[model samples]
Target: MRKKRRQRTILWCAIAAAIIIALLWTEQIALLYVLATLGLTILMLIVAFADLEGAKRSGQATDD
Candidate 1:
């Protein structure tokens, strides 16, 4: 489970980086849209990481 979570986190980070790169490679309206999408993706990634950490903490507490 931890390995799976780590893989997913890396995947999301790569996706976010790709979005930012695409946004940088574009121009005008498309760039704006991509940037917005990238921002949302980053936000979601942060939320996911936070949730994962919280779950891990809870799991540890239960184990103890």
Candidate 2:
């Protein structure tokens, strides 16, 4: 499950990088605000997933 979360995060980051690259290649300066919003959203998701994984680990440890 933790591996799944990490894979998801990596997938999202790769997708974002591709999108940013495409946008920059196309010279779409007007859409930078949109990109910024997307970047922040991805960042938040990463942090959330990390926290969840950490909590799971701690929970499991306590269960033992």
Candidate no. 2 TM-score = 0.54
Give the total clashing residue pairs for model 1.
Answer: 0
Provide the overall lDDT of each model, using Cα atoms, as 2-decimal numbers: 0.80, 0.85
Per-model TM-score on C-alpha atoms: 0.45, 0.54
lDDT of 2 by residue, 14-62 (tens): 9888988898899996797786988799999998777787777877845
**Best candidate according to TM-score:** 2
Model 1 agreement with the true structure over 1-64: per-residue lDDT tens digits:
9999999999999997886777677745677787788879999999877878777787784553
* Candidate 2 residue spans exceeding 4 A from truth: 37-64
Which pairs clash inside model 2? none
Q: Pick the candidate with the highest lDDT.
A: 2
What lDDT is obtained when candidate 1 is compared to the true structure? 0.80
Cα RMSD of all models vs. native, in order, equals 6.5, 6.1
Score residue 51 of candidate 2 by CA lDDT: 74
| Reference-based lDDT, residue 2, model 1 | 100
